[model samples]
Target: MVTDPRPGQILALVGWSGSGKTTLLERVIPLLTARGLIVSTLKHAHHAVDPDQPGKDSYRHRIAGATETMLATRERFVLFREHRSADEPDLALLLSRMAPADLYLAEGFKSAPVAKLEIHRPSLGKPPLWPDWPGIIAVVTDAALPACPLPTLDLADPGAVAGFIATRLGLR
Candidate 1:
């Protein structure tokens, strides 16, 4: 697989469904922003997604076979690119299309070749992904983890988690 690098480095958050990736991001994003760093996020959804409402013109247009649609407004606009094929764009392609920032936090694309932080919740009865996934830099968990060499951070402490992220990504 070929890899392309973007101006903003990518860090992926990986874990089981209930592992609190979103919760941690909600807390840590603010801390990262307060430190004067621009943060952008990419969410890889497993299911089919449509942001447009059912009765919206944009939705109707796409349903009628428009390959792409743009919803424009005074304050902001969104471009919807309809993919006719089954395969979704890879992480590199998505990142390239995004506006540059100090760092990019990716919530999925678990198998992608990028630095990753595994959010492990022992209570969730899920095995640690760090053992299976390549490029996992550290493990973030609330419970005590045994016999792991990677640095572990407290799940409740967003400050420490954010610090670890900045330090690893060189944004600090």
Candidate 2:
């Protein structure tokens, strides 16, 4: 279990592509929320990404050299910022922009120094990350890995994973 996480503890779901990181988060978020914990998520993309659509005012504004653009309505709002340079902001900088929540679930940023649950699928044929990464506190896998030293949980069971997270964060 985590000893003393920074305020609004951050946990990451990290794994290679097609290893079910996002899929687990999709299940875990609702479970966490239902338990009365406010949750926020941050996703990192390796490729250039734009949420705005072409021919739209927001997209046009961005294309016209606006460094930042925001589209807002009563229902929701999206803020898009352009990175002129290739350097992406680190996790700490990005977390500062988010509203306060009981927990933060990050989908990517696997290399960052944060507590993470490694999701593994044997069929993916990728080696487990915990062997080289100390930040990986536990693992969620669809297949057995007898060599892994950390606590292992079933990937198909989100409740068990959520409970583990809550327990580790000292929320339960």
Candidate 1, position 20, lDDT: 93
For residues 100-161, could you state the per-residue lDDT of candidate 1 as single tens digits?
78888999789888899999999998889888789899999998988778999999999999
RMSD of each: 1.7, 2.6
What's the lDDT for candidate 1? 0.88
Candidate 2 structure quality by residue, lDDT tens digits, 99-146: 888898999788887899999888987888999876898999999889
- TM for every model, in the order presented, reads 0.93, 0.93
For residue 138, model 2's alpha carbon misses the true position, in angstroms, by 0.3
**How does residue 140 of candidate 1 score in lDDT?**
95
Give every collision pair in model 2.
none
Over 4 Å off in model 2, which ranges? 1-8
Alpha-carbon deviation at 104 in model 1, angstroms? 0.6
